[model samples]
Target: MNGTLINYFFHCKRQCYLHAHKLKTEHTSDLVKLGKYYHKEFEEKDEDKKMINGVKIDKIEGDYLIEYKKSNSDVKASEYQLLFYLWKLKQAGIIKTGKLKFKDNRDDKEVNLTLEKEKELEMIIQKIKTLINSDQIPPVINKRKCRKCAYFEFCYS
Candidate 1:
């Protein structure tokens, strides 16, 4: 799974399901466009297509996998997304720690994929598979975050 799927899994199950099924709406979101711009600015010169099991890693600096984000509004989700990349790298026999860099906040958070965390990520991947295979979309949670979500209109309108 990609980082977007992992991010959507933590943010909204409905979004996870919709995105897995190819019902994308991020293109129309101004927030998404802005995020893309920030990501481009932080992107490394090489390693743009650093794909591991279909997940595109932002950058690889020696033994660290670097992920740059626009904000820390959903730090937990972002953490998991970084961990997911680390896990994929480990599976490919390239173990590496993760560094989450928030450009807007000017902060960096480290993420290490431990044995326990790797187990947890495996479980999460299984859960994601189950969610995507199911026919029903998850119900709207109506959280405040929905207002800024790219899939807001698809879910509410």
Candidate 2:
């Protein structure tokens, strides 16, 4: 229902399930801490949390929805997360493009929403809803980026 849910979907299903069930581990994660610090240090005056339909947007520039990232380690997941936001905005009759800002690398990537992408996002949202509603928690699958994930310890231990 939120960006974190979409992000966890791309990263790890187990994480997504855990997060949806209110099992949060981000507060104790160094990686999460670093990310928060990075955002705080580079946060612009105009950048503030804007909630739209329960989804908290990082920032909005004119007609562009801007999402800031600390790194590009999971660029795919990040992209999908941004797309999900765009989909949500579009559903509310606010058509806006997305811009991904990587502060550490000083890079920016533009994201455009299309009919195909919207259909894909809808399918994904349905899957996410079904997964979250299920009583069974998804199994954990190890990955290279697991070490830096906020739910790493919770999943591993």
Candidate 3:
């Protein structure tokens, strides 16, 4: 139910479900570490980080809730993660647009929490809860992208 969960839910359902079940492996991931280093290195301001509902947002500046990524490897995932933050903001009676900032300098993607997207998010949340509770483990995706995932060893080995 955190932003990473939302991102992983889109990136790989198995990773998301495993994370919910506390089968964490990201700490051992070099890619993950690199992203963290990149994030800390580029953070605009310490005060911009915000915490709400137990999730840490990267930054909130003006009308944009900005999310930073090391790369645009998964744009959809990044966008949805930002959207989840926007939804959280809405719940707190704060509405703002979302911006995705890639350390690789890819063009930013602006996300708006339209009514349609809000409904989609509701469904995604329900699906995430269901996936987390289900006893069945999701099958390995076995894609090239899986090679870069923190759960790659757990899934492929």
Candidate 4:
């Protein structure tokens, strides 16, 4: 349950549940459209979806997770998201371990996650799941990162 899908809920539970369990949605933004393009570009099914699901990966070594970012400013969240994906993989028994990778053609740069920081991430996962299942919208701290979130208005309003 700790994956991109869950991370989406970390921002907005309703959105995550709607998209994951129900696949319910009609509207799509430019960012989402572009994100789909990136995912398609980096996806590699030959690697075996079942195999990659819960295996511990040292590095992206391959397309493990093609996290596309528009800038380095969002690296932290991207890493968190990727780790959550790994967690999901682990939960589903797909991957036992893996680090994050961030790529952005806009900045012509890439960042390989070196920080383990798994303990902290594990703690947050528990908290997030608790809050999400409780059916509560997390408070907005009004950070710069909130600017790009699709649910900003719904949550902050």
Candidate 2 lDDT by residue in tens digits, 1-157? 8888888899899899999999887899888899998777656565456788766788888889988899887788898999999988887888899999897686788898889988888899999999999989898788887888888888889
Model 3, position 40: C-alpha lDDT score: 93
Between which residue pairs do clashes occur in model 1? none
Candidate 3 residue-wise lDDT at 149: 87
What is each predicted model's overall lDDT from 0 to 1? 0.88, 0.86, 0.89, 0.51
> Which digits, one per residue and each the tens of the lDDT, describe model 1 over residues 1-157?
7878898899899999999999888899999999999898888465544677666878888888889999999998999999988888888888998999998886889999999998998899899999999989999999999999999998888
TM-score of the candidate numbered 3? 0.94
Off by over 4 Å in 1: 44-49
Residue 121's C-alpha lDDT in candidate 1?
85
lDDT tens per residue, model 3, 40-150: 986755576868766577888899888889999899999999999999989888889999999898798899999999999999999999999999999998789998888
Candidate 4 per-residue C-alpha lDDT over 1-157 given as tens digits, one digit per residue, 9 for 90 to 100:
5455545655555555444444433234556666566555545432433345553232344535444444455455556776665555556654433333334644433333334655667677676566546644445557665556555555457
Off by over 4 Å in 4: 5-27, 44-51, 54-70, 85-116, 140-147, 152-157
Give the top-scoring candidate (TM-score): 3
Q: How many residue pairs clash (N, CA or C atoms closer than 3 angstroms) in each of the candidate models, in the order given?
A: 0, 0, 0, 14
Q: Pairs clashing in candidate 2?
A: none
TM-score-superior candidate, 1 or 2: 1
